[model samples]
Target: MFPIWIHTKEEVKRLLILGAGGFGHMIQETARLLGYEEVVFLDDAVKGADVIGKCCDYKAFLNEYDTAVAALGDSGMRLYWTEKLMEAGYQVPAIIHPSAVVSPSAVIGNGSFIMQSAIVNTNTVVEHGVLVNSGAVVDHDSRVGCGAHIGLGSVVKANCVIPSRKKVEEGEVIFSTRRKIDGVTSRNLEDALYAFGFGLQCSYVKPFGEGHINETYAVYMPTEEGDEFAYILQRVNNNVFKDPAGVMENIFGVTEYLRNVIREEGGDPDRETLSCIKTKNGCTYFEDNEGQPWRCYNYISNSVCYQLVEDPEQFYQSGNSFGHFLKQLGNYPASSLKETIPDFHNTVKRFENLEKALKRDIKNRAITCRPEIAFALDRKQDCKVLVEQQENGTLPLRVTHNDTKLNNILFDAETGKGLCIIDLDTIMPGLAANDFGDSIRFGAATAEEDERDLDKMHFDISLYELYVKGYLEATKDVLTPEEVESLPWGARLMTFECGIRFLTDYLEGDTYFKTAYPEHNLVRARTQFRLVDEMEQQFAKMQEIVREYA
Candidate 1:
């Protein structure tokens, strides 16, 4: 038997959801089924008819709504908002779907949600702010810690314990003391840890980031003081990065050079740059029994990463950080670096790849995206602008950080300045404009890259100006005149090339990029194209801003 939560119509009057995303919608339906008369939503990013106000506006609705639930997907964000709601004197209840089966012996904490068809068997303990997704199962005597997420269809076997804030991937199986996921096993993790000479026994390991190209994990080790996430382990995606050895070689060379530079400039090398941890035999990385390349890095403490541009100053700091990166590597022989991904930023080649995907049309998806197809076709000449300049010896090659998204730069928690530049997998010899342009393409956007509503997407010129000001202030002395002039073109063509790549993947049956739904790639391409259109409309202003900054 389970605790009776089915309230009468008069007993449950109104319910509030802190997040207004897909998960919030599902919670709304579940609330209605549980006899709640009215439900409203508060979201920071979303705007809709049902959204009463932003998340910070919760205090205003206290008199009208007495109960609330934090419906966010990210475990950390969910836990943060849940605490805020509780502090505000709102009843933060554990939301169990009517269809879920929970044993009366199981203990569920407040602010937890047990979704439809999920099961909590005898003696299971699920802590606060945890999410047991649809169809997930928690077996007997198991303990799920605070803010942990049991993904859809995942199984936690008997007597297993999932640590705080850990995430179990969908379809994974967690045995008594081991975990198994696609392509990586518990034995493989143990071997890798041993190879890295991690002196202490590992406390736990869990998925870490939102990167699409690699499998990243945080490795916690027990010490005399306490348990600490001392290192980061990663399995390189061979499908995307064909030459793992060559990639490691480039990273080793760059970090070694960066260490010397930071030391001479009176900076802490460990926090300023990545420190790659080698294997017992002094190898840059270790190969698992399955021949997968695994590497580890010493974790940098007291730093933060932002997924979106919430503040203009942070975006400016990101620009300064990347610009400083370019200036520091200005004298290093750029030509000595290998092309990790051959012709990685070749806008012309990207267009050709899109044409090939259109010809194959294996999924016959091209017909459904004719407008996007035409969008790429019309920009055929635009793609050639930078490639032609590079071929004609007008633009100079430099060491470029191909992935310059804001999240790749870690900001110092104390000073709120950019501390380290990460994700060096795509570092190669390329145009400086491409690096500068990639930042603007992502950081200056008004909405998310995959936002379905086109009306919400726009290019914010003010943010673009802020980035240019910071970048040019740091690299003005090192950059050549021709390179500086090409910055605006970089912004436009990089966005155009990215859209072409997305549309190509959509046509090729979504092979390259990971898609959550059928039209995910298409929706992403639309947002990119929308940004490109706005950039074209404001081209003159963009050039003036770049010139003013330079």
Candidate 2:
């Protein structure tokens, strides 16, 4: 592998490319045209380091060979060879194909390779051990980290950071060194696109569908060292809810507090990551683009943290992962880091929305949903009880992960243990019961929330147990007695909350939620309501289990 702007002291020299791939051919021709007859190609199984008359496979013979290029157009491949050759005390050369165009101001470090037809635009930095493969374009002001490889035909937009040691394979990622201006953002992370000021990049490889909101894409920005980060970029789908940022802010507040609290308790400090992104001068985050809010985010590499729990004992011994997570949040001394989330799990707010929805319906019934559903919602005096309590200031509130699903709970790929908690878009101040119950509710459901078959839609106790054991192992020690007691009820409440939202979307014609079938939202709503009913039947058993486990 050769560096993109390498400093070659003396003239005519021999270079070797180690693969017979398309990139290897480009290197062979480019080397010759540039007045050097020292170009040789070698593939993985090539016998004597020589092949006669094959345009690229020549210029070498016998056991005597020169330094080689790891040619298959991926950084991981290059990293592997670079390590082997370095360990063998052989020279691992960095070379740039003649046809590739690079900016005058761009910086290229040692031991990196640039393939043919790749364009590195103005002010971009291609660091040490980086791979700028064929047809890839690094736009102006971008940063390509050390040992990172930009795959064939991929595009890294202006001012973005390509995290070190990460591989961006076959796609255009629109990330920036600058943040988006406020106002519009999409929770939809389909790949790096301009949405509500938030950058949501997704990784279409391996785990295809993981997130609950927005689309996702893999992204690695410049700034990291030999570390290959598998990041994600996604957009915010604010049209799904009336107040998108408000919901995000609420979730963000609680998680930030939990991170701080955990640190105070001498637990894992990396679990809590809340970043404040600011947009560029012309980049507005609140703009409506194609009926969705514009937003963007930096997706960290999962390989960097393949699991959520590193050790179950540590989950308990680390001063109680959950307890520490909550306990030390009050210790972070930074004033700007602390914030609040409004209307988190407040049933009263739902009632208020129900009332407003009813008044609006009274004026324009055509704009309303089913009369029965709307009327029932309008007449929901039960939620008013919770609202009055909220007003009376008797409701319990704390930091919470609103979308507390297991997939959201990242587990280590290597050890199958827990690591840090990620996906903080929905951290907010809510009842601890809501967090615990929601974790179980989503993890244990027999079928997917939007699965078409109603019969398949039931809770799986085994799966629920797996999730509960993990959650309990993480939070048992720090949980308040009220938090523990309210857990079963919390699950019921969250189930109902989800059911209400699903039904609301279904009645509203399915515009808010993405669906595979026409009545998918309705099906989901029914499933949740069914689960709620089931939970009601098992209320006693659920409480018993909680007591047994807690």
Candidate 2 lDDT tens digits, 1-550: 5434453534446665666666666666766665656776667555444432232333333234455545555666666655554445445555667778877777776557777889888978887668887899999878888779888899998868888788888776656654442222332332223332223221122223455456544443334363233434445666544465554554445555655655766755453343333344444244443555444433423423311223333222221223334444423332332233356466656555545544554334324336335434643554454345435655455655566655564444454444555566555555566767676566556766766677887765545445455556666776666567777766777777777666655555566667777667666766777677677777787878777778
TM-score of 2: 0.52
Clashes of each: 0, 93
Error of 1 at 497 (Å): 0.8
Off by over 4 Å in 2: 1-212, 220-229, 240-344, 351-395, 460-470
- What is each predicted model's overall lDDT from 0 to 1? 0.88, 0.57
> Number of the top candidate by lDDT?
1
lDDT of 1 by residue, 103-188 (tens): 88888876889999999999888988889999999998789988899999999987688998899999899986443333234787
Residue ranges of candidate 1 with Cα displaced over 4 Å: 1-185
